[model samples]
Target: MPSPRNWREIPARYRLEAARCRGCGKVVYPARRACPACRGQEFEKTMLSWKGKVVTSTVVQVAPTEFQMEAPYAVAIVETPEGARLMTQVVDCDPGAVQPGMEVALVFRLIRREGHGGILCYGFKAVPAA
Candidate 1:
Protein backbone atom coordinates (compact mmCIF):
# COMPACT_ATOMS: atom_id res chain seq x y z
CA MET A 1 0.00 0.00 0.00
CA PRO A 2 1.18 3.49 -0.72
CA SER A 3 1.82 5.76 2.21
CA PRO A 4 -0.80 8.43 2.90
CA ARG A 5 1.60 11.05 1.56
CA ASN A 6 2.16 9.20 -1.67
CA TRP A 7 -1.54 8.52 -2.07
CA ARG A 8 -2.45 12.17 -2.04
CA GLU A 9 0.07 13.42 -4.55
CA ILE A 10 -0.40 10.49 -6.90
CA PRO A 11 -1.33 12.63 -9.85
CA ALA A 12 1.77 14.76 -9.55
CA ARG A 13 4.19 12.08 -8.45
CA TYR A 14 3.13 9.20 -10.60
CA ARG A 15 1.21 10.51 -13.58
CA LEU A 16 2.60 14.05 -13.59
CA GLU A 17 -0.61 15.09 -15.31
CA ALA A 18 -0.59 18.50 -16.95
CA ALA A 19 -2.32 20.12 -19.91
CA ARG A 20 -0.74 20.88 -23.23
CA CYS A 21 -2.96 23.15 -25.22
CA ARG A 22 -3.72 21.75 -28.64
CA GLY A 23 -4.02 25.19 -30.14
CA CYS A 24 -1.15 27.15 -28.68
CA GLY A 25 1.18 24.41 -27.41
CA LYS A 26 1.34 25.99 -23.99
CA VAL A 27 1.75 23.59 -21.12
CA VAL A 28 -0.54 24.28 -18.21
CA TYR A 29 0.17 23.10 -14.72
CA PRO A 30 -2.14 20.53 -13.12
CA ALA A 31 -4.12 20.07 -16.34
CA ARG A 32 -6.20 23.13 -15.78
CA ARG A 33 -9.95 23.25 -16.17
CA ALA A 34 -9.35 25.54 -19.10
CA CYS A 35 -6.35 26.64 -21.09
CA PRO A 36 -5.14 30.08 -19.95
CA ALA A 37 -3.22 30.79 -23.12
CA CYS A 38 -5.63 30.33 -25.98
CA ARG A 39 -8.70 29.79 -23.81
CA GLY A 40 -9.23 26.55 -25.67
CA GLN A 41 -11.10 23.62 -24.25
CA GLU A 42 -8.99 21.06 -26.08
CA PHE A 43 -5.99 19.75 -24.21
CA GLU A 44 -3.59 16.84 -24.02
CA LYS A 45 -2.11 15.57 -20.78
CA THR A 46 1.63 16.06 -20.46
CA MET A 47 4.33 15.50 -17.91
CA LEU A 48 6.62 18.22 -16.61
CA SER A 49 10.36 18.25 -16.19
CA TRP A 50 11.68 17.89 -12.66
CA LYS A 51 13.83 20.99 -13.15
CA GLY A 52 12.92 24.65 -13.23
CA LYS A 53 14.07 28.17 -12.36
CA VAL A 54 12.54 30.45 -9.76
CA VAL A 55 10.75 33.41 -11.31
CA THR A 56 9.68 35.10 -8.09
CA SER A 57 9.21 34.20 -4.44
CA THR A 58 8.37 35.29 -0.93
CA VAL A 59 8.57 34.03 2.64
CA VAL A 60 5.21 33.58 4.25
CA GLN A 61 5.32 34.99 7.77
CA VAL A 62 1.66 34.34 8.48
CA ALA A 63 0.41 30.91 7.65
CA PRO A 64 -3.04 29.46 7.82
CA THR A 65 -4.41 28.12 11.11
CA GLU A 66 -3.44 24.59 10.10
CA PHE A 67 0.06 25.68 9.03
CA GLN A 68 0.65 28.25 11.74
CA MET A 69 3.68 26.45 13.07
CA GLU A 70 5.18 26.30 9.61
CA ALA A 71 5.29 30.02 9.21
CA PRO A 72 8.22 31.70 7.49
CA TYR A 73 8.16 29.07 4.78
CA ALA A 74 9.47 30.01 1.38
CA VAL A 75 7.31 29.79 -1.75
CA ALA A 76 7.99 30.60 -5.37
CA ILE A 77 6.67 30.68 -8.90
CA VAL A 78 8.99 28.66 -11.08
CA GLU A 79 9.17 28.45 -14.86
CA THR A 80 10.27 25.29 -16.57
CA PRO A 81 12.02 25.05 -19.90
CA GLU A 82 8.96 23.25 -21.27
CA GLY A 83 6.88 26.43 -20.78
CA ALA A 84 5.08 25.35 -17.67
CA ARG A 85 5.04 27.32 -14.42
CA LEU A 86 4.66 25.87 -10.94
CA MET A 87 3.89 27.51 -7.64
CA THR A 88 5.61 25.47 -5.00
CA GLN A 89 7.43 25.79 -1.71
CA VAL A 90 11.22 25.97 -1.66
CA VAL A 91 13.06 23.80 0.85
CA ASP A 92 16.61 23.02 2.06
CA CYS A 93 17.62 26.63 2.28
CA ASP A 94 17.30 29.74 4.39
CA PRO A 95 13.77 30.91 3.61
CA GLY A 96 14.92 34.52 3.74
CA ALA A 97 17.41 34.11 0.93
CA VAL A 98 15.20 32.67 -1.85
CA GLN A 99 15.74 34.58 -5.05
CA PRO A 100 14.30 34.92 -8.55
CA GLY A 101 15.81 32.81 -11.33
CA MET A 102 17.43 30.39 -8.90
CA GLU A 103 17.56 26.86 -10.25
CA VAL A 104 15.61 24.24 -8.28
CA ALA A 105 15.02 20.54 -8.43
CA LEU A 106 11.76 18.79 -7.65
CA VAL A 107 11.30 16.81 -4.47
CA PHE A 108 8.43 15.34 -2.55
CA ARG A 109 7.97 16.73 0.97
CA LEU A 110 5.63 16.48 3.89
CA ILE A 111 3.15 19.26 3.36
CA ARG A 112 0.99 18.93 6.47
CA ARG A 113 -0.75 16.65 8.93
CA GLU A 114 -3.10 14.08 7.48
CA GLY A 115 -4.68 12.13 10.28
CA HIS A 116 -4.28 10.98 13.87
CA GLY A 117 -2.32 7.96 12.73
CA GLY A 118 0.82 10.07 12.14
CA ILE A 119 0.07 10.36 8.47
CA LEU A 120 2.08 12.87 6.47
CA CYS A 121 0.57 14.61 3.46
CA TYR A 122 3.28 14.79 0.84
CA GLY A 123 3.56 17.05 -2.17
CA PHE A 124 6.16 18.47 -4.50
CA LYS A 125 8.61 21.02 -3.12
CA ALA A 126 11.64 22.70 -4.68
CA VAL A 127 15.19 22.52 -3.46
CA PRO A 128 18.30 24.18 -4.83
CA ALA A 129 19.61 22.22 -7.78
CA ALA A 130 23.12 20.89 -7.41
Candidate 2:
Protein backbone atom coordinates (compact mmCIF):
# COMPACT_ATOMS: atom_id res chain seq x y z
CA MET A 1 0.00 0.00 0.00
CA PRO A 2 1.07 3.57 -0.53
CA SER A 3 2.45 5.48 2.41
CA PRO A 4 -0.56 7.78 2.64
CA ARG A 5 -3.01 4.94 2.46
CA ASN A 6 -1.04 2.78 4.85
CA TRP A 7 -0.59 5.57 7.36
CA ARG A 8 -4.31 6.34 7.41
CA GLU A 9 -5.10 2.73 8.29
CA ILE A 10 -2.63 2.37 11.15
CA PRO A 11 -5.33 2.77 13.77
CA ALA A 12 -7.62 0.09 12.38
CA ARG A 13 -4.82 -2.21 11.21
CA TYR A 14 -2.58 -1.81 14.21
CA ARG A 15 -4.83 -1.03 17.12
CA LEU A 16 -8.12 -2.45 15.88
CA GLU A 17 -9.69 0.94 16.42
CA ALA A 18 -13.19 1.29 15.07
CA ALA A 19 -16.15 3.62 15.14
CA ARG A 20 -19.55 3.05 16.59
CA CYS A 21 -22.39 5.06 15.19
CA ARG A 22 -24.13 6.83 17.97
CA GLY A 23 -27.44 6.94 16.13
CA CYS A 24 -27.87 3.25 15.46
CA GLY A 25 -25.26 1.61 17.65
CA LYS A 26 -23.61 0.15 14.59
CA VAL A 27 -19.91 -0.48 14.56
CA VAL A 28 -17.60 -0.01 11.65
CA TYR A 29 -13.91 -0.64 11.24
CA PRO A 30 -11.45 1.90 9.86
CA ALA A 31 -13.69 4.63 11.27
CA ARG A 32 -15.62 6.28 8.53
CA ARG A 33 -17.25 9.69 8.66
CA ALA A 34 -20.72 8.25 8.18
CA CYS A 35 -22.29 4.99 9.21
CA PRO A 36 -23.28 2.61 6.49
CA ALA A 37 -26.36 1.49 8.33
CA CYS A 38 -27.85 4.81 9.28
CA ARG A 39 -25.69 7.41 7.57
CA GLY A 40 -25.10 8.82 11.00
CA GLN A 41 -22.25 11.26 11.17
CA GLU A 42 -21.88 11.05 14.92
CA PHE A 43 -19.63 8.25 16.07
CA GLU A 44 -17.52 7.20 19.00
CA LYS A 45 -14.19 5.51 18.76
CA THR A 46 -13.97 1.95 20.01
CA MET A 47 -11.43 -0.81 20.15
CA LEU A 48 -12.21 -4.27 18.88
CA SER A 49 -11.56 -7.49 20.71
CA TRP A 50 -8.40 -9.30 19.68
CA LYS A 51 -10.23 -12.59 19.61
CA GLY A 52 -12.97 -13.72 17.27
CA LYS A 53 -14.46 -16.69 15.44
CA VAL A 54 -14.17 -17.49 11.80
CA VAL A 55 -17.51 -16.86 10.11
CA THR A 56 -16.55 -18.22 6.73
CA SER A 57 -13.34 -19.17 4.96
CA THR A 58 -11.85 -20.05 1.63
CA VAL A 59 -8.52 -21.41 0.43
CA VAL A 60 -6.79 -19.49 -2.30
CA GLN A 61 -5.25 -21.93 -4.70
CA VAL A 62 -4.20 -19.31 -7.20
CA ALA A 63 -2.64 -16.28 -5.66
CA PRO A 64 -1.99 -12.78 -6.82
CA THR A 65 1.50 -11.76 -7.87
CA GLU A 66 2.18 -10.05 -4.58
CA PHE A 67 1.19 -13.15 -2.68
CA GLN A 68 2.15 -15.96 -5.02
CA MET A 69 4.60 -17.53 -2.60
CA GLU A 70 1.80 -17.89 -0.09
CA ALA A 71 -0.67 -19.49 -2.44
CA PRO A 72 -3.14 -22.00 -1.06
CA TYR A 73 -3.41 -19.94 2.10
CA ALA A 74 -6.64 -19.58 3.99
CA VAL A 75 -8.58 -16.34 4.21
CA ALA A 76 -11.62 -15.84 6.37
CA ILE A 77 -14.18 -13.38 7.56
CA VAL A 78 -13.71 -13.34 11.29
CA GLU A 79 -16.42 -11.89 13.49
CA THR A 80 -15.31 -10.41 16.75
CA PRO A 81 -17.38 -10.59 19.88
CA GLU A 82 -18.61 -7.08 19.27
CA GLY A 83 -20.23 -8.27 16.03
CA ALA A 84 -17.77 -6.52 13.77
CA ARG A 85 -16.36 -8.68 11.01
CA LEU A 86 -13.11 -8.32 9.13
CA MET A 87 -11.42 -10.35 6.47
CA THR A 88 -7.97 -11.59 7.40
CA GLN A 89 -5.54 -14.30 6.61
CA VAL A 90 -5.68 -17.39 8.80
CA VAL A 91 -2.13 -18.45 9.54
CA ASP A 92 -0.03 -20.78 11.70
CA CYS A 93 -1.94 -23.85 10.56
CA ASP A 94 -2.84 -25.82 7.50
CA PRO A 95 -5.02 -23.68 5.24
CA GLY A 96 -7.51 -26.44 4.64
CA ALA A 97 -7.96 -26.97 8.32
CA VAL A 98 -9.58 -23.59 8.89
CA GLN A 99 -13.33 -23.89 9.31
CA PRO A 100 -16.35 -21.83 10.21
CA GLY A 101 -16.87 -21.24 13.92
CA MET A 102 -13.15 -21.83 14.57
CA GLU A 103 -11.78 -19.67 17.30
CA VAL A 104 -8.88 -17.41 16.38
CA ALA A 105 -6.70 -14.80 17.97
CA LEU A 106 -5.42 -11.86 16.04
CA VAL A 107 -1.68 -11.27 16.11
CA PHE A 108 0.41 -8.54 14.65
CA ARG A 109 2.47 -9.68 11.69
CA LEU A 110 4.13 -8.39 8.58
CA ILE A 111 1.53 -8.11 5.85
CA ARG A 112 3.59 -7.28 2.78
CA ARG A 113 6.29 -5.04 1.38
CA GLU A 114 5.66 -2.38 -1.19
CA GLY A 115 7.34 -2.79 -4.54
CA HIS A 116 10.84 -1.34 -4.98
CA GLY A 117 10.65 0.87 -1.89
CA GLY A 118 10.13 -2.23 0.28
CA ILE A 119 7.90 -0.36 2.65
CA LEU A 120 6.84 -2.90 5.20
CA CYS A 121 3.14 -3.16 5.92
CA TYR A 122 2.03 -4.75 9.12
CA GLY A 123 -1.42 -6.00 10.07
CA PHE A 124 -3.31 -8.71 11.92
CA LYS A 125 -3.29 -12.39 11.01
CA ALA A 126 -5.55 -14.94 12.67
CA VAL A 127 -4.06 -17.99 14.32
CA PRO A 128 -5.94 -20.83 15.90
CA ALA A 129 -6.69 -20.28 19.56
CA ALA A 130 -5.32 -22.93 21.87
Candidate 3:
Protein backbone atom coordinates (compact mmCIF):
# COMPACT_ATOMS: atom_id res chain seq x y z
CA MET A 1 0.00 0.00 0.00
CA PRO A 2 2.78 2.48 0.92
CA SER A 3 6.44 2.37 0.10
CA PRO A 4 7.89 -1.09 0.66
CA ARG A 5 9.89 0.03 3.71
CA ASN A 6 10.22 3.57 4.97
CA TRP A 7 13.52 4.39 6.64
CA ARG A 8 12.20 7.42 8.47
CA GLU A 9 9.73 4.78 9.64
CA ILE A 10 9.56 4.04 13.33
CA PRO A 11 12.43 2.04 14.75
CA ALA A 12 14.36 3.01 11.61
CA ARG A 13 17.13 1.64 13.74
CA TYR A 14 15.24 -1.13 15.51
CA ARG A 15 18.31 -2.93 16.64
CA LEU A 16 17.23 -6.03 18.54
CA GLU A 17 19.22 -5.56 21.69
CA ALA A 18 18.32 -6.54 25.26
CA ALA A 19 19.65 -5.64 28.66
CA ARG A 20 20.10 -8.61 30.97
CA CYS A 21 20.77 -7.29 34.41
CA ARG A 22 24.20 -8.18 35.66
CA GLY A 23 22.70 -7.91 39.14
CA CYS A 24 19.51 -9.74 38.31
CA GLY A 25 18.11 -12.02 35.64
CA LYS A 26 15.34 -9.63 34.55
CA VAL A 27 15.89 -8.41 30.99
CA VAL A 28 14.64 -5.35 29.20
CA TYR A 29 13.90 -5.00 25.52
CA PRO A 30 15.46 -2.29 23.39
CA ALA A 31 18.17 -2.71 25.95
CA ARG A 32 17.12 -0.43 28.77
CA ARG A 33 19.15 2.73 28.82
CA ALA A 34 19.41 1.75 32.46
CA CYS A 35 18.46 -1.38 34.36
CA PRO A 36 15.04 -1.00 35.90
CA ALA A 37 15.36 -3.98 38.22
CA CYS A 38 18.52 -3.04 40.08
CA ARG A 39 19.21 0.44 38.81
CA GLY A 40 22.41 -1.16 37.53
CA GLN A 41 23.84 0.88 34.69
CA GLU A 42 25.99 -1.91 33.29
CA PHE A 43 24.58 -4.09 30.52
CA GLU A 44 25.73 -6.23 27.62
CA LYS A 45 24.14 -5.80 24.23
CA THR A 46 22.51 -9.10 23.34
CA MET A 47 20.88 -9.67 19.96
CA LEU A 48 17.46 -11.29 20.19
CA SER A 49 15.76 -13.42 17.58
CA TRP A 50 12.54 -12.11 16.08
CA LYS A 51 11.00 -15.52 16.39
CA GLY A 52 8.47 -15.85 19.20
CA LYS A 53 4.96 -16.90 20.23
CA VAL A 54 1.99 -14.62 20.54
CA VAL A 55 1.54 -14.16 24.26
CA THR A 56 -1.57 -12.08 23.88
CA SER A 57 -3.48 -10.19 21.19
CA THR A 58 -6.46 -8.07 20.34
CA VAL A 59 -8.04 -7.09 17.04
CA VAL A 60 -9.05 -3.49 16.67
CA GLN A 61 -12.47 -3.26 15.14
CA VAL A 62 -12.66 0.53 15.18
CA ALA A 63 -9.45 2.40 14.74
CA PRO A 64 -8.67 5.47 16.75
CA THR A 65 -8.18 9.00 15.47
CA GLU A 66 -4.50 8.24 15.33
CA PHE A 67 -5.10 4.87 13.71
CA GLN A 68 -8.47 5.24 12.03
CA MET A 69 -7.88 3.20 8.90
CA GLU A 70 -5.90 0.64 10.81
CA ALA A 71 -9.00 -0.55 12.61
CA PRO A 72 -9.57 -4.30 12.82
CA TYR A 73 -5.83 -4.94 12.81
CA ALA A 74 -4.37 -7.59 15.08
CA VAL A 75 -1.96 -6.42 17.75
CA ALA A 76 0.00 -8.64 20.14
CA ILE A 77 2.61 -8.98 22.79
CA VAL A 78 5.30 -11.33 21.57
CA GLU A 79 7.75 -13.20 23.75
CA THR A 80 11.18 -13.37 22.12
CA PRO A 81 13.89 -15.98 22.35
CA GLU A 82 15.84 -13.68 24.65
CA GLY A 83 12.85 -13.72 27.02
CA ALA A 84 11.96 -10.10 26.43
CA ARG A 85 8.31 -9.52 25.65
CA LEU A 86 7.29 -6.74 23.26
CA MET A 87 3.95 -5.29 22.22
CA THR A 88 3.43 -5.13 18.46
CA GLN A 89 1.14 -5.70 15.53
CA VAL A 90 0.64 -9.05 13.85
CA VAL A 91 0.77 -8.88 10.07
CA ASP A 92 0.72 -11.12 6.96
CA CYS A 93 -2.13 -13.17 8.42
CA ASP A 94 -5.81 -12.64 8.88
CA PRO A 95 -6.46 -10.66 12.04
CA GLY A 96 -9.24 -13.08 12.82
CA ALA A 97 -6.75 -15.93 12.70
CA VAL A 98 -4.39 -14.52 15.33
CA GLN A 99 -4.30 -16.48 18.58
CA PRO A 100 -2.17 -16.93 21.66
CA GLY A 101 0.90 -19.15 21.30
CA MET A 102 0.87 -18.83 17.52
CA GLU A 103 4.41 -18.84 16.15
CA VAL A 104 5.39 -15.54 14.63
CA ALA A 105 8.30 -13.82 12.90
CA LEU A 106 9.32 -10.20 13.18
CA VAL A 107 9.58 -7.93 10.14
CA PHE A 108 10.14 -4.24 9.61
CA ARG A 109 7.02 -2.59 8.34
CA LEU A 110 5.34 0.78 7.82
CA ILE A 111 2.96 1.62 10.65
CA ARG A 112 1.29 4.95 10.03
CA ARG A 113 1.41 8.21 8.06
CA GLU A 114 1.64 11.37 10.07
CA GLY A 115 -1.10 13.89 9.63
CA HIS A 116 -0.54 16.24 6.67
CA GLY A 117 3.14 17.05 7.37
CA GLY A 118 4.92 14.31 9.26
CA ILE A 119 7.11 11.32 8.71
CA LEU A 120 5.84 7.86 7.82
CA CYS A 121 6.42 5.76 10.93
CA TYR A 122 7.66 2.21 10.59
CA GLY A 123 8.47 -0.56 13.03
CA PHE A 124 8.57 -4.32 13.56
CA LYS A 125 5.45 -6.42 13.16
CA ALA A 126 5.00 -10.13 13.91
CA VAL A 127 3.44 -12.50 11.42
CA PRO A 128 2.67 -16.19 11.21
CA ALA A 129 5.90 -17.96 10.43
CA ALA A 130 6.09 -19.69 7.06
Give the winner by lDDT: 2
Model 2 misplaced regions, further than 4 Å = none
lDDT of 1 by residue, 36-90 (tens): 8788889987888888999999999998876788788999998888888889889
lDDT of 3 by residue, 1-130 (tens): 3444444322423766566877776677866557777888877666678789999999988877877777779999999877888888887789989999999999877767755776676668898998
Query: TM-score of predicted model 3?
Result: 0.78
Give the C-alpha lDDT of model 3: 0.77
* Candidate closest to the true structure, highest TM-score: 2
Model 1 — which ten-residue stretch has the worst lDDT? 1-10
- Colliding pairs, model 3: 9-122, 10-122, 60-72
lDDT tens digits by residue: candidate 2, 66-127: 99999889999999997788999999999999999999999999999986888889999999
For candidate 2, the per-residue lDDT at 9 reads 91
Point out the higher-scoring one by TM-score: 1 or 3: 1
- Model 1 residue runs over 4 Å out of place are 1-9, 13-15
Between candidates 2 and 3, which one is better according to TM-score? 2
Off by over 4 Å in 3: 1-13, 33-39
Q: What is the alpha-carbon lDDT for the whole of candidate 2?
A: 0.93
Better of 2 and 3 by lDDT: 2
